[model samples]
Target chain A: MKSTTTWINSINNRFWRTIVNSTATGVESVAVFRIIMGIYLLFVTTPTYTWIADLPKALYTPPIISFVNLLASDFPGRNFLVTVDFLMVASIVGIVLGIYSRFATLAFVILKVSVLSFQYSFGKIDHDIMLPATLACMAFSGWGQTLALVPDKRSKWDSPSKSLSVIAVLIGFGYFSAGIEKAIHWLNFDLNSNGTARWFYLGLYNLQRQPILAPALKNAPFWFFKIMDVVGVIFELTPIIAVLISRKAWRIWLFFAAAFHLVNYLLFNINFIGNGLVYIAFINYKPVYRYVANLTKSYIAKALILAAVGYAAVIRGISILTSQNVGIIFIPDNGNANLYCMLIIWALICAALFITIFKTGKQPVHDDLEVVSPQLT
Target chain B: MHSLKFTGILFAIFLIPFVLRLFGLEPYPAILFPSGPETVKQVNGKTEIETKQLFAKKQNGQWALVEPKAFMYPVSAIQLAKLVSKNMGFKKQKPFPLKGKIGIVNYLYRSQNSSSSAAEEAELRNWIKKRLKRGNYQTSEVKVATYSNIISTTNGNILKKELKDEKYYNLD
Candidate 1:
């Protein structure tokens, strides 16, 4: 009995230790993640709910959420949706600036969900839960503890925060779930059950999303698609285990995951770039933050960078409002050339992240005795 | 104690959904994909697949093939199919103005708007017109149809297309 008890205690100790060590992040790291996510949401993932508002109410098939039916009964007006869009933008700005960031995050989450719920009510439910889930987790995290006008008082800046670890676990389990679903449905020993080829055909014929590689890969061998199906299932299934095992394992898995998304985009024109951006939570950004700080020590350099970001944001906002087809860099279109450009850009980003992870090595664990970074303090 | 409590909460949050999904109840935010059995099926020694297409009739009295993407804006082809099969008469369900009850309650009642069909039809026509206007064609009618095709199971090449159902709406 005593031996069993001791074994249980050891396992519990190991689990908690792993969680704490994996999530041992500096305040600057979390702050950098906040800024990066805020910018990504503002420019790349800005909700175009105005078009959804114009959809006929007859098509409103509310999701499982009961409150959505009530909302659909008195469907929101176009002006109301536009106002929600603007408020979402304002809250994103607040998140970037770290001014009442928790509140800003909460507001953004509420507004985003409200609008997206209505959008999904038109019988199309997109699996876009990651961004909102991340934002919800961030609202209660130490992301605003550093580089903030209003840092969260409840957060212990010097200690390891559970937020990043939680996010990593969430993403891992999400992939695991997908992997399991595929395994159940796609793992039959039949040669004809090739999920990858099926999706490729669907995109090519039914969806009219002819990416650059679609034509080339159309006549590819059945065995090639079978291999892809196996690899994809394995890739999705291993993330949770990798995260729990070691930081290096997690980084390696993430690189492969990014590659997987890129491959999906290449063949199927299905974009999961938002999910890729959410992987930023798993990175230790303190070194990057420090490098940028050192590079922009001059006041003029800082001002210039800020101006550039602001100008880009303003231009993106204008493009969205005017419904202009902002080039494929910002919005992916049906152009083959633009598809190639996006692929190259995404590949470079994945490579850079992989290099950064290897170069930085393991993040240091924070304990009561460890000295906090001066800049963070 | 704090770590234990936090770990417990996290486990609960993740595990509940995991367990629920195992039982086939997809609670909100469940990770799902639209992959399943092979679409190509062998029926009576013949391999075939089902396909859907949207077509528009121009003012020039010619029916031109319309891309499903042109008319199904802000919704997927699959979603449009569901809306058509369920709400529209495509699947033989009473066309709109459906009367139903909420749960097992005695007093709670629900009724679809009578104008819903007309409104939805009008919107679909507008979408068709907008898409055709880009190509400098004036659309006067639209049709949503499904086809069953004998296909090459090896390469997914269609051998022949047999129209299954064709629903037409006059824009005039």
Candidate 2:
């Protein structure tokens, strides 16, 4: 009887703890999601951006419509899709800045989904679907709960808390949805015994025909392709098992799925519905921040920030003086590089924030803040 | 200690799908083509032979072959377009017929008109006798030759006459 009571109390504690942490995470996510959407919109619409029309030509469907093909077609005002893409980007930025976030989130969801759907309207996969879903969740969840603009210490709605739970659930749904899609494709969907090899052969043939990567990927053999095909199938199917098992399992599943998506973006130059965005949505944000904070020694945090700032200054200075391109040690050209740059910049900013907090004698932000009601206190 | 281990496990779990994706498993959608018919017929006069058509139609839950008598091999659009362009003498080559799109052509097989006198005559007589049996046509005006598994039907078209195979026909 005593042990049962103890177990019940533990469960209750866990439930309440989760509520508080999720609330905080949800608030943080609004900022991140908004900024990301804005940047993406701006980047795609940039006049100097050249890759808009240079997608692999082999991706053409005989009976179905394709975005690239549509762009090349006699369709009127087709340029409006780019305008919508830029709007979504702007909306996300607006959302993150906590400036008219509700309206921004709604606009972002509508424009992003419509354009992506119309672009790949012949048919689209999970990546295309997930972005709109994320935006929809964000819109309803009151993601920007703790905004600098609002400056409200005591609020009734607990907006961020509600949003966090919704976001986490949606992110989980994205994985579950992908798993479901894979199950559909794999059920009695045997390409034949030698189908795997044939599939790889077709992929390689398609890759070799690509104007950009043709020279590099053309020489890869049938055996290499066969292995990749089988392995790819296994990766697609593994997530279904991963997300349901445990919290640890979900994290692993999400990480590898993100990496898998990243690799596809890099090697195959596929970018339609990217995996990274969906992966971010699935993450246990509070735990991740806590874990990273714990790993950084309180002493070295300042030095790390200084080093980063110094490195940035040196790179900037060298670029300005030489009038020659710096041979930076990094992934070059390709769409993948932009994502990598975003990740780096985000990490650097986070690190700077952490150092500032420590130096100013301010406590690291707690995963949960319990604001007692005036009447209770 | 437990939290650290949990964190490590979490990271590993996340990394697995990505690693699998990197090595070549994509979580993207599969693209497929529509089924079409098996047999195509080109009826010119009383002589009828099968012509190759592009797509097959799915009827009553079964895929019916479009050109039943004519064997179909998956041919690339570019190759078919080139063949048609060369024959038709188009100013510029057009894009090939797509998967669901069908292309129709009027094709004929030809036999030799040669100086190998006696042997050619014997071959033509044998050819005429075979077509008479298979086609069941009493018209002796149509001369037939069986060689290279091809049954040619010629009706005094010089273009058809110019193109000859291993078989022989009499100059009647």
Candidate 3:
């Protein structure tokens, strides 16, 4: 009887934490998330902005009306896209600067989703829906109250928004859905034999476009790809399991998630950097301020930041500047420098993260005056 | 606003399908996360062999496959416009729905262009045969069929059917 009561209490505690505990995010953390999102949006939308100008006028079926044939042409034209792009730029600037961040985030969502769904309406949809989904939640969540040019302590958005928890759940849900699909798929195939891997999994590698790695990946051993196939299914299923468990498991899962993105980027050109940045939604950013507080007092963090910045941006920039206007260019015009730029960016990200972890991973969260209704509390 | 209640509601949305699936009703509605058809198609050899990056250049409003090239450049704005227009028009026929009492009227409305689907299968076989003949090989039976799959989402997975085709030729 005592053991049964303990079990029930444990289950209840876990259930409560899963829903409410994850929702307690500080505004500073929310602002950082918003900033990261703003940066990611700029990078993601750049190619579409540069090339696919016709996406706005394409046949669009909103996810709701996708089932029926009511209105496929209820989308904006190129002129609207051009106007949206201007507004998007303005919004990103606002979000990053914390100047009217909420309104900016809302604007970005409307414009981005309008363009994205219309592009995918004609029998194509990529796994980039996290952007709109996350943004939708952000619009509702009171995440706009911190670290911006104009902070709101008492805005309705500051109330515990369902979006904060929803974003975390959705991340796990994506993996679980994929895992369930793949597991069922594996069950339907003759797993004892190698034929399944040859026919189904081999085609995934065919999408690779990396100049060097693309050709190499094609020649990689079939068994390697077979192992990778199994690993992919497992990796896809992991976030769901991790999210169900504790924050430690979720953080550990982020390693695999990062590696997954890295391999995909290196092997194939399918860069979903937006989803990677979205992982911030799952983590508690209370440690970030502590890391910064300790780091500024130390010379090592400052030196590392400067050196990384100088090597990544400055030296690369200098090389590009010096190589210009000459018949023989030292820097490859094929844009190989972008790879080094990526390396630098990742290096800085790692440094920032490591410093934060080292400085404040053990420190307790300093709570502010959190006032919600009894139901929310 | 109660965490338990919120989670309970979300779980309830997904629970019915999950419980039904556990009880062996696989077609139950997927609310939160769907077990999609993309994986299901690969089970029991259902995936179709389809060509991709299959671009056709437009000259005077006619579609012809662009010859095999070392690399595919990004399709231009004008080409993309034409591609979308062309994509919207190419509606292949649906297979006869899994039905019993729905009768011939529903079948007639649903199953148009089935002959074109057969023709498409034949054309795919011929394309394979011609390629094999070019390589100096005799051909045998060619297999052709349409298979089902899906593009999954959070709400549910929508079913999609596409044609899988192959041709057998002299090997020894």
Candidate 4:
């Protein structure tokens, strides 16, 4: 009896310690997440300027103002919207530079939500949601402290552990909700019109409107899809499980997760790159960070990272400019040339990432990036 | 903020909403997944390829096909789609007779929770009724119909018997 009680007590202690200190060693990984988030958000929101600039004259009634009776019927006009666009750009810069990161993040949250409310006021709401959610978490976390050009030095509450802990839980919770929703869907599956998983699967295939892939998916054996759907439900729940398990289990789960996303992308053109990228928060990247830091100690690594970032920026700018008349001087003259440029850019990024991760001959890369949770009374 | 306070605040933000969820109070629509499954609408019959363009408005006490923009000013065909999804339903409208002079609005609606939300339906109808009344069209009876395909709007004078020929409201 005493032995069992002691074992239970030790387990309880260990669990809390893991929760409290899971983030102590994820500063570098969290930094990478922050930088990726900043760049992605800027790229994502760049297209909104055209619509935002026409808000005053645009037909759809902006949100919040619609339900309220006393708000202004007349809009403030396109110039005012231009000011909003300019401010958004400035905030994006701040997010990237890590200068006043908290403020920039808050500004981003408010601005993005405010504009999105207007943009979708007429009704399509699911586009580009991951960025805002990501930005809000980073704003809540002190992620800018490590990787920013000018790191915020507020030491009181900006510990890596606290910041990362908050982010990890949020991500875990997000995926868990998705998994739960799927379960709820299947719960009513029996009562649905056709009363089977086939209807549910067909609904998911965009009502058989999936042009290229629909025929194959339809022709596949019914048992095949039913089993895949069941597996998908379990896999979706694995994200939350990943957060709760040991580091080794978490890594294994994430590997399967990457595969799941890839398969979904192929089956449906629904690429959730932004959502997938945020999962890096759970990884212990101390070794990766250390290697990069060491490599940066040599000028070659510094130049390489800078080159990667620069190439990434130019590619981003060109893609955005080509799609919209953003008034940029340099435009991709042709689609084939632009595609080639993108491939080269990706290759460069991969080379930089590979060298930073494995090129340092001082030590071999190991799979033991586990962080020890400190016992706290 | 001290570390404990920081931790406390963060957890509070997470937990309060969770507790609210337990009590059946969903958080404000923000950066999160739907609290429940957002089932993608599936229509069995031939559906209009461009859904937002198909709409039927009640004019002169008769349901007639009309352009969506006539009712939802400035809402693009795509924007109209966003509005139809209950989850994406846009809030806020310009105050004065929201989209003035438009009466007896008509548009395609694909909503996940519309079947269950009678109160939501009543509230919207009342709002639209008030708007239509101000625009000099006496209107009554806001009824919603779901159909798989709405081929095209017929000419203003088409008889009710001709609706089948126009492919309007042809539910499978």
Candidate 5:
């Protein structure tokens, strides 16, 4: 009994230590997520920009139209969808700027809910379903102090950490709900063919729509997909246990989830919400500050040199390769080539910022408050 | 600490593909899977006709036969699923208004009709005809419900009988 008590005590200390030290990382993560989500929302809304407009008609079908036909008059339409898109863009902007965060969060919820309702009208779901719930949590939790519209409050009582904890709980709940859904829908409980597991495979392996994987998936020699499905369902169902196990474990999960989104983005051209935001909820803000400060002090110089080399190599490589391609050479001059050029230019600008920061080195800056939870007492 | 060789190998694995893609590695096939209009074909089948358009397939395997007409818009999976689920009565038929460059046409539709028209059916059909004309497809006779049960916006020419011969497009 004494040994067990001692072991519990050690685990408790380690958990708290990890939480406290990682505060800055949390703040940085929130900033990055807010900005990315903001820009992504903005980019998706601008329909005149056809690249993002590459979409299919089936997505606009409202899942609730039949129910609505029986129950309400609301059916998904282009104008209705456009309005939701506009609201989403505004909310993302609000989130990024930290302006009127609660209002932005609320607006985000309203717009996303309508969109979700439309989506739910069809029986399909994606990770974005959790965004509204996360926003609901953010409405209570104040991530804005670090990267938001409001000025930082003087007291610990109003610190973003309190709100962040709530956000953390919400994040956990989002995973938990999905996990529970798998549990409730027992067919999805298995690792191989179950719902969450299937998506992970389909989304990552680029088989979400194609019928080719159907045969291999159904009649595979090994139960590789089956194991994946089971593990995913278990992880999603009991994420609190999985999440609370260790920060490293949580980070690993986040990494896989992010990779899942990235694959969807690149392979299927599907955009998913919560790809970056989940990382924000998992952030422990204090360590981020320390890490940034340390980087400001030490590694800036190295990062610049690496960035320069990467840029030159990439540009030269592109020029050489595309020059020899017969098909690419004859194509009508689409704007993509120039667009990539702009991307490289911005990359160089980022590299320059890195150099500037490293050359100047770090100056002593005032420290942000460390979160000390009252619940711990 | 990790060894330098391992780190170098890791960086190389990450860097090489990106480099290759930048240099016209051409990740996807150059020849786009041709559009439906280009490849619309008539299937020699009974009961169901099939239209071979991109994203959607007609039952009889002919693009020209499904009435009122159908088309598709690329949408997020969430939206696609929601649309499919909301319009769940795949077997139930209801009169729906459809528009083309020609004009509005009323047609009875079942869920198996297609998702494009359900969302913006007319627009999608127009787009498919315009954009994806390369895929195999064919035109076929579409079943038309009598307009006698409804109001007419044109000259109030009351049809004396159910006009089965009224020209209608069908996609299998």
Candidate 6:
């Protein structure tokens, strides 16, 4: 009787703790995520909704949620969409600057969903839902409490916010759903039903230009792709499990997730950079923020880095507006260019990880927050 | 009690969509990846994969190859191929009498019929017309053709590509 009571109590404790505990490091960590995500939205993801607006109206097919159609009686005109796009940029600037951050995030989400829904109405749905979802969650996360020009006194900077935990759960389930779909299709005993190879062939047949690694890997063994298919499904299905296990497990899962996206980009030319960036919410970003702060003690060095990023963002913005072909690093429309960009990104990530692990020695313990499991806490 | 309620709501938000999707209902927003080809077949003792390509007739009375990616900005090539081969058409239905606006609008439209709808044909014609105009060609007809991508089972080189079924759509 005593042992049974102990087990039940443990379960009860876990259930409540998992629900109530915050997964984030602090307000400063969320602030960093807001700034980085803002820059990514502004520069890397150039919405071609204005171009989409030009497509024939006969092709407009509403998504599963049809009420979106009622938002506008008729399909929006190009000028209207362009205005919305410009306002979206302005909102992103507000988010980055931490000026009325929640309002900016909310505005951005509304405008983004409006445009993306119209784009998807034409019969193709891109898996870019996470970005808007993350923005919505961050709107209420109290991220602006730390870095804002006018920070809210009500915002608790030291206490971990539950918003990150919510975002993590959303991402975990998103990938879990995708994994279930793949498992249903690819788990058959047939060896020839290699999902990766089939996607590669589809890319070759459909794309205007061949994927970068297609020439080299066209003749790769059938077994290799079959292995990749199995591994991909496993990676997708395990995120929720990782989340329930511990924070260390979740971080390790993220490392693999990054590699998965990079490989997918190289082989299939599919970009999931936005979804991958959302993974930052699950990480303990306090150490990373401190490291960056220590390195940028000098104002001149900080200004130089800021200027460079601003310049690149402007160049990317101009290229999108003018529809001109810039260098592969800027646009990365082709495979070779994508490969180089991926390599550079991976290198920088590795360098950051190395510095953080060695220089920081070990992560200091936080007594206030649970590490996704009771045992760890 | 409030914390428990919030946690319960969060769990429902994540799990409800997943459960709906599992039962083949997509009433909620979720991430979906394109499913690849179903199977690889053996033809004449060689491995074979099949895919579809799109072509548009030019003013010179020749069928020129059309890259769907060029005209269909965000649509995947596989999706375009499926759309072309299946000849799918959307049917606009009357809004159902439901309690909420969302529920009413949700049932307002669906894809119906194996045969092409006027809207589908018009959309295709527009794409073909735009593609041809870029190359300074005037044409009103497009073709959806299937090709067998044959590969060596021993070595991975593609041995040959053989064209199979051919379907044409004329806008004139």
Question: Per model, how many backbone clashes are there?
Answer: 0, 30, 4, 13, 74, 0
lDDT of 1 by residue, A277-367 (tens): 7676667776688775465567796677567557656765654465443443245655565566667657865885587568546556453
Report, for every candidate in turn, its global Cα lDDT versus the true structure.
0.62, 0.36, 0.46, 0.45, 0.38, 0.61
**lDDT accuracy of residue A96 in candidate 2:** 42
The better candidate by lDDT, 1 or 4, is 1
Whichever of 1 and 5 has more TM-score, that candidate is: 1
The Cα error of candidate 2 at residue A329, in Å, is 19
Report the alpha-carbon TM-score of model 1 versus the true structure.
0.82
For residues A140-167, could you state the per-residue lDDT of candidate 3 as single tens digits? Answer: 5555666555754455445433466566
After the best TM-score superposition of candidate 1, give how far the Cα of residue A64 lies from its true spot, in angstroms. 2.7
Instruction: Kindly report the TM-score of the first chain in candidate 3.
Output: 0.70
lDDT of 6 by residue, B115-145 (tens): 2457656775676576557755556666778
Candidate 2 clash figure, as a count:
30
Which has the greatest TM-score? 1
Interface RMSD of 2: 21.3
Model 5 misplaced regions, further than 4 Å: A1-33, A43-72, A76-84, A122-127, A146-159, A177-221, A246-249, A256-273, A285-377, B1-71, B77-172
Q: Which ten residues in a row have the lowest lDDT in candidate 3 chain A?
A: A320-329
lDDT of 3 at B170: 23
Interface root-mean-square deviation (Å) of every model? 5.4, 21.3, 12.0, 11.4, 20.5, 5.3
Can you list the residue pairs that collide in candidate 6? Answer: none
Runs of candidate 4 with Cα error greater than 4 angstroms are A1-16, A20-24, A43-45, A53-77, A127-130, A140-142, A187-212, A290-377, B1-31, B34-80, B83-172
Candidate 1 docking: what grade?
acceptable
lDDT of 4 at A320: 35
lDDT of 4 by residue, A232-254 (tens): 76776675566566444444555
